[model samples]
Target: MSLALDIFTVVMVVAGLFFFYAGSIGMLRFPTVESRLHALTKADNLSVGFIALGVMPQMAEATDALKLLLAWALILFSSAAASQLIAIAARRNRRRDP
Candidate 1:
């Protein structure tokens, strides 16, 4: 049981890290601001969720796990809001420039 939990944690964490790496690559490789923002937000959001889930099993207490999940939820909301704002600004700028 312990080994299974450990393996699950490791797999989730690795998946999260992979998404983070992919997001970074997208940020660098994407040609347009909208595309880059889309990639980054999507990947990062998933990465955070995965990492939070991975860490939850390692927590010693239920409250601790709940707290971690709450944090992840907050991050999701904030990131979504932030990404929307950025996208709006990018669109506005594009309109103004052209």
Candidate 2:
């Protein structure tokens, strides 16, 4: 059982890291602001989820796990809001420039 949990945690952490790397690549390679934003937000959100899930199982107490979940939720909400705002601004700027 312990070994299984450890393996699960490792797998999830690796998955999270992969997403992070993918997101960075997308950010650098994407042609447009909107596309880059889309890729970054999607990948980052998934990475955060995977990392949280990976860490939750290793937590010693229920409260600690709950706290981690709460933190994850906050990150999701904040990132979504920020992405929306950034997209809106980019749209406005594009309109003004052209």
Candidate 3:
């Protein structure tokens, strides 16, 4: 069970990194700020979330697992809020300029 879990966790981390890469590429190549924001927000949320969730299972103790979960929650909340703020800012800028 532990071995399988380890493999799964590794895979999740790798997937997260893949998302990060995709987001980076999209941000670089996309023509518009809104399109880039879409890639950045979606990819970052999924990548960080999956990676954090994977860490919870690999923790050595229940307390550690709880801590990991809490950390993950905090990250999720902050990232979501930040993304919203960025989106709002983008919209405001677009309205002002367009």
- TM-score (all chains, Cα) for each model: 0.96, 0.97, 0.80
**lDDT of all the models against the reference?**
0.94, 0.94, 0.84
lDDT per residue (tens digit) for residues 27-94 in model 2? 99999998999889999999999999998989999899999999989999999999999999999999
Task: Give every collision pair in model 2.
Answer: none
For model 1, what is the C-alpha lDDT against the true structure? 0.94
Model 2, position 80, has a per-residue lDDT of 91
Q: How would the candidate models be sorted by TM-score, starting from the highest?
A: 2, 1, 3
Distance from true position, residue 89, model 2, in Å? Answer: 0.5
Off by over 4 Å in 1: none
lDDT of 1 by residue, 9-48 (tens): 9999999999999999999999998899888999999999
Candidate 3 C-alpha lDDT tens digits along 9-76 = 99989998999899999999999877887888789878887788777788889899888778777877
